[model samples]
Target: MTQSMNHEETFENPIIPGFYPDPSICRVGEDYYLVTSTFHYFPGVPIFHSKDLVNWRQIGHVLDRPSQLNLDGTPSSRGIYAPTIRYHQGVFYMITTFVESKKGARRNFYVTAENPAGPWSDPNWLEDAPGIDPSLFFDDDGRVYMTANRVPPSGREYPKHMEIWLQELDIEKKQLIGPKYSLWDGALKQIHAQEAPHLYKIEGQYYLMIAEGGTGFTHSVTIARSESITGPYENCKMNPILTHRHLGRDYPITSVGHADIVQTQNGEWWIVCLATRPYGGEYRNLGRESFLVPFRWENGWPVVNPGKGIVEMTTKRPHLKSFPWPTRPACDHFDTPQLDMAWNFIRTPRDHFWSLTERPGHLRLRLKPERMTEICNPSFVGRRQQHMTFAARTMMVFDPQNEWETAGLVLLQDHDFQYRMESALHESKNIIRLIKREHGEEEVIATQEIAGQRLYLKVEAAGQDYHFYYARHAEEWQVLAEYMDGRLLSTDVAGGFVGAYIGLFASSQGHDSLNVADFDWFEYIGVPQQ
Candidate 1:
């Protein structure tokens, strides 16, 4: 699908792939920083840096500390959502919402950092912020404004009747003040889910861009303009500046929306949006990813993707210099003192369950009583499954004393839906088994008796078909399971907003154990698309 007339001039879609969604970008001087939501995953809102817009490198996470975010009982896809990153004067601000569904609450907050890489301040919760997808707009007069999506004051006339609201934000006090004004009700009022509001001042007019028609197949980006920041805005005649809904279901890219615009130092404009790539018929296991598109100002309104009119699978790269960073290796040896930024814990770990220096060159996880079936923090660390054709392997050594102890790899969608391959003592026999947990039903699909405790577990995916294999040593390999339903890890079947994650896990069922599972090395490699 990547048709490059001049090969070096074009860059592919999804500059940053996998489950990164609700992308927002802001450029300060020559450096550009972007952020995306990380729902239910610890160390939320990963920040990426880029110079040319075609290549990016992840600097760190905005919420890296356990004190910055609390996801103790938050369910998958319901925790953090729609982070917006903006820089003002000398500080960078990242604002987002934390949905504590167990408490039926949505708390909006912003954190500031002098350097975007580390030491982000703790949450500065807004008292009057009453909605999700909150964004900040800094005006020329040194005044700050906040906008978010909330229910219409008059309530719903149709389904999902949400409206964007704007109010003055006293940045010094860390709260919203003054009168709140209800802004545009979206381009198509009948098609709801109006959210992801971002206010921009372009050509001396206040322009508001938002995502409408939900975040599914009908997702889109719409624009409106107002002479005043707190006034009645007029929708663009050609609204829905970007979308792929009309391209039918078979299109490679769909559900394109929730965008944020950035103007480079050279005066070129670009957009970063969230879109899904469904390889296997309406099933997007990789979740909504960060996509880049060309943008321009036409007459009085903004245009997306220019001549193409839709977010293409491949398009022209930005006009900036082609800057590329040093390549990263596909394998992690667990020799570093700290975990890599790519790895994440499920929820907050109240107790220390993982270590790196304990065994010097291995990631050791103590087998805890909590299981992946529950909402508690089991001994698990996961990363996004970034490719459709990828193979991941890990070498681990563990001893299962009883049937209650288990350790292995887990392809997780959520607590209710997962595929677990573990080395456990089944009937007092050392067995490597594959268990399928779908829609709350647990069933053992396959089991193979293996020798010794040193194991090599691997999983491979070719399009929608997934295969699981294991070995007693590095070279001797055998298939444990094949042709399993990979759609079980998709949002369509799992009913979550997040993507599938491959994780390392250890569990003791309900019994307390002092044993640990040590992973010496882990590697993931993806094949280039043909």
Candidate 2:
């Protein structure tokens, strides 16, 4: 439940890895709190805690209640966007946009809490707030300001001609009360998708930091400054203080943008940003992850990574003491009263389709009518595929009473793209089948009759190749599918804002069934490729 301090002088680049992206950082006294966007996933916006700014541990989620967020049929990459976390006067506030699928409308809202560990308050929705990636700034003059991306009143003059806007927020009423002003768009007038703005008043001047050029290969971080909160802001000579676009297509880390800067208690400055690790060519199965880079203000402008100017895989640690978390368990035995923080559901569950007390020491999942192929919540539970070289396995006792019911494991990219291995009865015989769904089309890869009453399912990944295995007896494994293409699970091909996941699933496929999949245990582990 806690992390021990490490005395190491160096730490890795991605302080936090996997699918977590769009990192926003804030420091309270000596303790640092960070949050990241979780699109199309339940319990949106995970909050992390760190002491040294290098090591971190997930404390909880910012939106944990169903009443706070509703993503019943949200498509992949279309739910929660970027979030900015700010602390003020004994109160913690988190502001972000909920990107709705209905005509692509976005609603900006914020939630507050006294403790970041959180029994957070309901969202205080902001009216007249358009666009996404909303941020909050608490100025020292007893005034609060909200900044976000929006189009000009006259509309855009060119493609991706977005603008950053500023408005005064009433701290007491939680609403915008002053005239809105359009801040600087970007140093490059034609920069595409200019967004993710964070305001800071430093050294008698107000500074505006933002992400520009979209969230792809051309993604970048830019800065501007002004003497007043809402006025003519001057662009930094080195506008893009951080980016990986010019490094070419084969860089280890690409799409490096959406950064938030924080100054440590020791007075050292750092930037936390989201970037993708593309392996086996340009396929990023790990999705956009959070990375930390050294930052400082030089000549009244921000300088990222200084001499290097690029995000590194390993770098010097912060001046503060290390706060390394104890190694997390690679396996969950389903003995706990609740699911671990590592698990997340796709969209929000409208009803109880899963339980822990039903089968004592086992996670029981009911065979629901909903399927993963659609946007609606299905009978599934999953965790991120953290390592490029990893293995995920689960021991389950499931027997398909009919051909309409299937329950087992899945290697999922999104609702339309995935590789599902499930248990069923073929010709009245127990069987396990491997099926793939790409772009709403599904094809069965392999099928085999399973032995014994219980089934063991597993999938292993070595870089980009995924191998599926199964066992009917303890320690006796058989290859159901080998060297299956994993690139189909990448955002490059699947086109989403999420990474791949290994999860437990049970579906009736539009049929009514009184069946359940009892998972005795689930294990996921990462290893260095041999």
Candidate 3:
């Protein structure tokens, strides 16, 4: 997809930032569409559109229906893995793996839509496909193939010893036809887990690319090519076409790999991949973010970030003309008919638990039996905390009818690590409390009895510190908890593939309270870096 560039604007790296990772792009005429992994969040695989590669707007999610994605008991970072989006003929196809099957194994599925902003068809499960990071390639002669990583057919020499495989796909029937062929293992001899494979047929030569050395500090992108669609593929002389693993942990950007390549209308080539931004030491709380890098062909091989061989914070925008899209509102007033695309639920939500229309201009969340610390779905709706330094506030009116009922604002990393400033019944008194849960241990840090039912809860983040505040009114904010270590909510500390999410939550703490919390508004404003 190509976009109409009508203006000139300098775009930065991470064109699509904050918890959005493993991005795959496809160009259909003048429009470019991209998809990213959403893990256990419902309405999975966010779809983005751009005229130029730099500026992107989320059009919609590829899996908007519960039937299309089932993450009921799935833990954080266990639902959808890497996804690939490709436009073939008049259809847009997305292929991904669901890692939480009841059968205790990974399952692959594909969905299609006529338009990228979709009512995507229900999943066509690949019953025989046996791996993650599945990608589809449509050749020049109407031939189609699917590629993925799997255990070697011969046997398993060691854990994570895998190979890239290719199989012909029957487009009309949506099934695999020919025998699966083993393509390439990986580039580095010591590296295992060769995954995230993409195929490109350029200038009559078939090129195969894969990510190796896992997805952590050792992450790197490697390339190989063959004259035939299936190899005897030769590894590139300069393997590891792109990576920042060797740059040390202090480089700010690390864990770079799982990339997809695209050529613009003007013939400029680029890649979108996942990388981390370590803040306050080598802890990456933001998780893997999407980054853009430029590339060129040298001696029939692709060379990424040519001069430096590392992703930059700022680079020249793609050759395509620039057309900027409107940004999402910083505050949600609950004034819209439907929730914004930026908001996401922890899992498949109970249809009647939360409503924007029940009370005009307010989001009413009824207390449920589950707590935020449970693995099951909870009454929680949140958006990614995109900025390291930012302020998030919510006005909640909740008079808990029972001691078990609570409603408040939360910075959630997962079930085990999170902080909540909540309004609940404490000793038959209406009080606001600051609670912290680290590694499954819950602690009540501070509590104050409030005179009114309506109160404002805020959390201010600066670098590695988070301060929780509460106020009887919006203007008089008093600190409840000061300089709480925010790194405790980071991915490095939490042990997950997700970033921190600032959201509103309501729960009965495992008891049925039949209580409700109404949120007047939710605001998240970024504090500029000084």
Candidate 4:
């Protein structure tokens, strides 16, 4: 194991964890770039960079513009989904689906930039976009093409209804300019929900890669190839090119899909995809995160996990060893124009969701008004949950002498499965309490009075459960609760595409301008003790 203290027994913790899903990767020179699906999260499609695919750092977001990311009343997990990121020439492009509401008001959107972190252009709608998971490929013949999954109107069965379609793309026109052709649908039958088409060209043939099966435990990565970009593409003799299901239900990684391939400067290939690790094989509180797999060509075709046709948790083959892996960024002072790749939102946030100016080196989050039926959008910022049993601690001063003023750390799981352990005014004294909303019911488990100008709060998400612990006046840390089931608060059950997110939040229960919380620092320690 990369870290000895991590008992789950994987090579290492997630490179990028906690809600980072549908990852796509690209390599330019010695630097590697990655982007992931940001459904309903503002600053959509976060761009990350690394020298080694394992140690990634957030560069910036691609859809920071309002035109590119529309969060005006868009439901949680309804805006963007399954983004495919690719780079060509001096430009980087990513495409995703914008599902406005349950009524099925959805469309395809694209954004580009000369640099990953940049002045990304506004969203360009594919005028003929009908389905979802669109990806672009630049061929050797100086042609650009697009491929995606569409539910054919004529499909009859549950499995055959969805299939991949391809068309010629006019970059200058920003749209498809050729006829649509059907590509391989997995397993001939059981592979129904095949989508997220990413294409690559090797030698004289074209390879189409996609994430098939549902994005659940049954998720998989599949590939097919065509001598021509539009012709009949043949499936890989050993399909489901990469997966973890064979590892059985007790394995570490789960729900692997939405992958992107990158070649090292030395000409070696690797794929970065999203995977989740459930604490108890049922609850994935850390959400879907990015992972890496090495690849090579066999008999003129890419063999992801040769012989077995699935990805392994560990491998002996080393990456081409060209450039050094990028250093993971931590102990951030929050002085930059953007938050680190670690941060995530429970839902699409408004303009005032966060800011660094108010606290300078520290992040200042303003609680937005909450819908009773929706997850509350308050001042929140958090690092990805990489370790299954790590601890997140923060020190904050919550003043205002009002019971309505609340500020503390949280083990957040969408709107349904969330636990708030907060510091609030209790009579004339400050009180720290642990409260949880389980199965649509709010319950308080512990409360204590503390005397201090600032309070320290800590939350531990380990082993499929969430535990709250806090200390006042430098006293011994007390465990507030243990084994709080969080899977109950998921989009799968609560209705969204997002997963459980653990972070810090501050908000006022009443309309008062004086209520404020000043946090000193937030830290997440992994199994390696870093």
Give Cα-based local distance difference scores for all models. Answer: 0.91, 0.90, 0.88, 0.71
What are the per-residue Cα lDDT tens digits for candidate 4 across 1-530?
A: 12123233233345676678888777777787888887766667888887756666677878776666766667666778877777788898887888877667669878788978898888888877778788888887789888888877566477435778888888888887868888765557877688888888878888888888778877888888888778688888777878776677767677777788877766667777888776665666666777777688888777774565555555433343323455554456677876665676644465575676788776665543442226445566654555666777877766646666677777655555677888877787778888877767888888887777677777776555767778764446887777877566554455556766667777765454545566666777755412
Better candidate by TM-score, 2 or 4: 2
lDDT of 3 at 293: 93
Per residue, candidate 1 scores C-alpha lDDT tens digits across 403-438 of: 999999999889999999999998889999999999
Best model per lDDT = 1
Off by over 4 Å in 2: 1-8, 528-530
- How are the candidates ranked when ordered by lDDT, highest leading? 1, 2, 3, 4
**What is the model-wide C-alpha lDDT for candidate 4?**
0.71
Model 3 lDDT, residue 146, Cα? 97
Tens digits of per-residue lDDT for model 2 on 1-530? 12334435678867887999999999999899999999899889999999888888999999999999999778888899999999999999999999888468899999999999898899999999999999999998789999999987888888888999999999789899889999986566758788999999888999998999988899999989999889799988886889999999998889999999998776778999999999999999988999999887788888887899999888878778766889888889999998998899989888889999999999999999889798888999999888899989999999788988899999888988899998988889889989989988999999998766599999999999999999988778999999999998999999978888889999999999989999999999897422
Q: lDDT per residue, candidate 3, 1-530, as tens digits?
A: 54455334456777876899899999998899999999888779999999988889999999999889888899878899999999987999999999984346888889999989999999999879998999999999889999999988887676778899999999789889889999986555577889999999999999999999888888999999999998899999897889898899898789999999999888889999999888998777777899999899999999998898999887777867767898677889999999889899998775688899999999999888888998878998899887779989988898888888899998989988999999988788999999999999999999998887899989998888999999998779998999999998788998878888888999998887678899999999985433
How do the predictions measure up, each by TM-score? Answer: 0.98, 0.97, 0.97, 0.88
Error (Å) of candidate 3 at residue 444 is 0.8
Q: Which stretches of candidate 4 lie over 4 Å from their true place?
A: 1-15, 317-319, 322-338, 346-355, 359-361, 371-376, 426-429, 474-476, 486-496, 510-514, 528-530
Off by over 4 Å in 3: 1-9, 101-103, 528-530
- Model 4 steric clash pairs: 52-325, 417-489
Greater TM-score among 1 and 4 belongs to 1
Q: Residue 508 in model 1: shift from native, Å?
A: 0.4
